[model samples]
Target: MPTHLIIHGRVQGVFYRDWTVSTARRLGVSGWVRNLPDGTVEAHLEGSPDAVEAMIGKMRDGPPAARVERIERSEAKAQGAEGFKRR
Candidate 1:
């Protein structure tokens, strides 16, 4: 599945995006993660259903520093991305 995620609460400045990149890559997921101006983090995750779900699970407790309040997920078209990144 290709999924868009908006992560909220104490996400920025806590290395959430870098943690996401590492986690996504480790899970063999492909997509991009970026910090939003609204003090949230956004990401696109594309991979097997299991991998995507796993990635999302990890994102829930990001980097030991992030206090993830919630996450918003939605379906998205595949980006055909080769790897995960921090945008």
Candidate 2:
């Protein structure tokens, strides 16, 4: 199953999107992360349950400069994400 995560707070302009792309790649997760106009970071990650969870866990702490405040997670239907990207 795939998972979608919407992270809020201090997530933009801090390399969060870039870090998410690299981190997800390292964890072998497929999906994308983007910066919302409202200053939130949204991501869609697909992989094994464990891998997805790992990615989410890291997102909660983002880069050392990031201060993640809230993470909303929900199960998502697989969308066949080809690779990790930042947007």
TM-score for each candidate, following the candidate numbering = 0.98, 0.96
Worst 10 residues of 1 by lDDT: 14-23
Model 2, 1-87: lDDT tens digits are 698888998988899999999999999999998888888888999998899989888889999999998999888888899889887
- In the range 12-86, model 1's lDDT, one tens digit per residue, is 988888889988999999999998899999999999999999999999999988899999999999989999889
Clashes of 2: 0
| Segments of candidate 1 deviating more than 4 angstroms | none
RMSD of 2: 0.8
Clashing pairs in 1: none
List, in order, the clash count of every candidate structure: 0, 0
Best by TM-score: 1
